[model samples]
Target: MRPLRILLLLLLAFASMPLAASPAADTLAADSEARWVPFQLTTGNQIRFRALMDGRWVDAMLDTGLSDTAVSASFARAAGMKPLVQAHADAIGGAIPLAWTGLGRVEIGGLVRTGGRIAIITADPRATGPDAVDLFVGGDLLAGHALDIDYAARRFRLLPSGRMPFRGVTMPLRLAGSNNLYLTELAIGVRVQRGVIVDTGDGAMLTLTRSTWRNSGAQAGPVTSAVAYGAGGRVETDLVLLPDLRLGTLPPQTAELRIEGDTGFTARKGAAGRIGGGLLRRHRVLLDPRAGRMILAVNDAAWQPSRSTSGLMTAQDGRRLKVLHVMRGSPAAATGWTAGAEICAVDGAAIPSAYATSAVAGWSVGTPGRVVQLDLCDGNRRSLTLARFY
Candidate 1:
């Protein structure tokens, strides 16, 4: 599951608009035909599509960052596959015991494949994805096909696999050591060469190593100290509006970026950071992992990416909403909304309860510059009028 999407949505929350369901996996009239599958971008700007896992239709995220298409342990059990404990897998946060199994068949819009690998874990730690989602289609399978993602139109398509001309910057995709995932080197700030993991699964614009954030001396505007949540868990970060971000020889552009505190993640030999949906959403990206190449064409800039309306970044621990970070100049910051404080309620709606959390999250994503009230864990109450930070 994409964590940046969940955290950003928690800060900005999509207006909770209803979306039409993706087409179910019925037999296509023309099996060899190219099909455009419309995906719904959640309030957090995360992508999801209707997919078929073993002939059962389920909602799944289009996650290129993930090396292999994986299913939750529960889903694997439901599919009647015996999960063979393969040992453990380590991530940015820590290590988790992992299991593996095979799927009978997996189906995308018009594409179908049989006997696929699926990773199984005890639980889905990710906070994103629709409740109906059970699968995360990864890059290993996608690299062999012609996949087109049009963020401007908020849609993606699958074309027949072949040698097709592309109009964009092309880069060689190098696999992360001993893994099927691919990454490229990105020159950020000055003198800092960081590895960019092409991950559409992540929602944040960009998150850099804290050392990189400091060593580069990059100037950011209106800093917000907050905790960001994702599949692995929450981490401390200063959400900043980067004055500029450089990607190789590409033209520099001002972008929103996250500066994360180092948490002792076992970094790949020379790697330093990750690139998620935040940056990827700005382009029409095509990946060919097998051939070790990916193409990117700058999409229309008319689309507005998700930003914090309330200027608050929060995390849900158990039944409570912790105020992990607050954006500078936001009403919460001005009112001294400190990090590590629990939020009792938002807009007069109590949190710490499932329904209440949803209510507050929905309220947060509703609309920008709207007035809302807050009740903190310290027994203090304050009113906040929403405003966009980026």
Candidate 2:
């Protein structure tokens, strides 16, 4: 099926009410400016705006990543927007049951008009926490409009367009386990995946699910080093090299990607992965939450990596890890390591920077027969090892 048709069918299946007859186009043209305002949600999150429901205006987040507009059950009950029926929604996290309700009228940026039956689910119950917003406007609303997100200006723009800009190819996206939009084929071998939660709060290249990598024909290499946080907090993964990655219409190229075995894929299934600042920092990204589209303008001013180097590497979260940070059950985890233990020496030599040189350079996942002696120091004295863990 064509991408647009697929999106429409998905929307109609999820909408709770029958499609309402829209007002005449001329009637709407006159009131456009009076009803719409530039909307904003969390930066780099979703597009949101204020809309009138039952004579009251409320804040709503526009998420094309989702199939339908959902309201929190509590908020719906309070607003008397009860579900007319119940429908099942499949998300990356899991299958969610939701009630359906009709929204009288949806006015966007004072110009467009959309009236439909929307799904009403308990927002608090389905979300990780209560702060997870009250309303979600999904792909149903996006089908009729051209949407744009201006990050620098911090505003969202909507234009009435039958077709979206950047007609890239669409791929099936799966998060957690449910099938969604995986990537959009912009050029040959270049596809941009949606529903990727952007967490500027996090500082790393996009994280890939172990299954995502395994299925993508990418190989997991060695874990030469690891980073540790406080109190049993450590993430151990092998450094993986993706042969090529195509983001949107950008050219295909190889990049250093991390393999996360412990990623909470089952918990957050609605997202395929995350698109971080590392990629966006080099491009002007236009996000249309209402339209379910994004445009990436590569920045020539941004520094491009040389053919030999595969972009700059930064820690996933905030903390950095050393060789000792690799935990048990991991390639580095079984290295008989403990946190807070100091390294005294390596290979029967009392060398300075023993911790830095030995731990970072010596250990990896597939290294074979690489034996090295390590003098470990606690608060007391020292202990030595002859064989190294790969």
Candidate 3:
């Protein structure tokens, strides 16, 4: 009887004491520990952030498509990092030689990765700018980390592994070869496509293999031809729109997606395609590769379709604007504009030489039905009525 009485008294006393933290409280505490780091969206819509690499300040890009972290060859030489190994990697264009070296530390948003291998990437001579990317933070360092990107805020946060902040539809993430994260069960129209990669490095909304695009019963033509620059070299691609696309178990609102094409990368491992920043920017995304899961909360449900007015893909060559590709069925294609044709003036104004090194938008972009006149270096003049081709 005394033991029973003592037990009863103890239970009463414990019940009177304060209770421990609930699961909800624990989640809040964990979320509070996450620190937000601001990021900039480049003209190409790629995420760029300032990072400290081996105690040196550097501009870095978050690239999930890359198998390993990389530094520019120029940056490696300037930092005195000697290559320990030479290898080759397959890119969208082709296979390219790679040099691997040891990096002491890479810190971004106070998250540090130490003693990791980094590949050295050669810069393209055609891409000239003082603000070239110095480092690429790749999948090798992102594994086992919880990353939340709020595109509307232009900020991202790092939480403890297995901890996620945003709550929405959670999907399984497959960490495939080279630490690439692939999401499956993506429904484009009525057909379900599997093995879709999440590529933050790519600025396009989505990219499909040539075979995948044809198999989807999608209409041909009205595609804007352009040149995509990457690790190996430049590859010709066609940009189109994908309608009624839905991700795995996500919201039912069908998204109008801008899709590109690449023959090399998407065909590997039976991948259907890859989705990039153009689609991700509409949602608050949380990627937890360690737990093999991704969380997504749609921030914008309304679809904003891009209307290409100029239909001319041009690059600055020396002091002139060089035509890279003219979209078939576009105003430029209907004209005598050909690839390699250089432009001397636009709308009767001579282009300044500084435009060759500037980050300004090309003169080809403008409102629909806008009349644009161009003077070519070949002493030919042409007029184009800018309109939406697709």
What do the candidate models score in CA lDDT, each in turn?
Answer: 0.60, 0.41, 0.64
lDDT of 1 by residue, 1-390 (tens): 111123431110011112233322223225433466778866455788888776788778787666666676666778787875474544444444557665567778767766545566543354363354477777656656666787777777665554344578776666665454557656555665546566676666777767766777666677775555455555556777776676645567667777666663314323466677767777887666555666778775334444666666666666557766676766667667667777677777677456332535655544766887777777887777766654
Model 3 residue 209 CA deviation in Å: 1.3
Per-model TM-score, in order, reads 0.75, 0.50, 0.82
Q: After superposition, how far is residue 244 of candidate 1 from its true place, in Å?
A: 1.9
Better of 2 and 3 by TM-score: 3
Estimate candidate 1's alpha-carbon lDDT, on a 0 to 1 scale.
0.60
> Which TM-score value belongs to model 1?
0.75
Q: Which candidate leads in lDDT?
A: 3
Model 2 spans > 4 angstroms off: 1-44, 111-114, 123-130, 162-183, 186-212, 218-244, 248-294, 299-390
How well does model 3 score by local distance difference test? 0.64
Total clashes, candidate 1?
A: 5
Residues 22-118, candidate 3: write the lDDT tens digits. 2211121234345677899654557888888778899887877776777888888899988777766666555656677766777777477766466
User: Which regions of candidate 1 are displaced past 4 Å?
Assistant: 1-33, 123-126, 129-132, 158-162, 191-194, 215-217, 248-250, 262-270, 302-310, 315-324, 327-334, 338-372, 375-380, 384-390
Q: Which has the higher TM-score value, candidate number 1 or candidate number 2?
A: 1
Clashing pairs in 1: 13-365, 14-43, 205-278, 225-325, 226-325
Estimate the Cα RMSD of every predicted model relative to the unseen true structure: 8.2, 12.3, 15.8
Give residue 159's error in model 1 in angstroms. Answer: 4.8
lDDT of 3 at 274: 74
